[model samples]
Target: MKTEKRKLAIWMTMEAIEVIGLKRIVLDRDVAEAVGFFHAVIAPQVFATAERFGIHRVDVEETEDGRLPG
Candidate 1:
């Protein structure tokens, strides 16, 4: 569960760069805070809620270069 949340937080943080417009906009402090909170807080809640919906997957599939697959 801890590992899964950490992994999900990485993916979520990357997505946040675009969704939250954090690319060079917000300070590194914001990124740090967001990542930590996502992993420690949001990720757990997400997984708990997901189980109710039959969703158990937490890993993200990516290419060798770390890019999201199409």
Candidate 2:
């Protein structure tokens, strides 16, 4: 089988992430695309959680690797 490369974006924050208790998240868009469904492990809003992690400001960026190295 061949794999196609793809990217996905999900809204999340440092404090609210404990709801699902996921220590890590991995992107597997190829399977997700083919299956036509996927679930995001984190919440898509940072409205209240940011302050708990000392996040004064949140900067958004476009990325390829899906890792927050930048």
Candidate 2 overall Cα lDDT vs. reference? 0.39
C-alpha RMSD values across all candidates: 12.5, 13.6
Give Cα distance to truth, residue 1, candidate 1, Å: 39
Off by over 4 Å in 2: 1-41, 45-47, 51-60
lDDT (Cα atoms) of all candidates against the true structure: 0.51, 0.39
Model 1 over residues 1-70: C-alpha lDDT tens digits?
A: 4555423322223445454544443455576666655555556666666676676545434337532233
TM-score of each model, paired residue for residue? 0.41, 0.21
Q: Tens-digit lDDT track for model 2 on 1-70? A: 9998655344554455443233222243355442222223232344245555565533334435533332
List residue ranges in candidate 1 displaced over 4 A.
1-29, 59-70
The residue-level lDDT of candidate 2 at 64 comes to 58
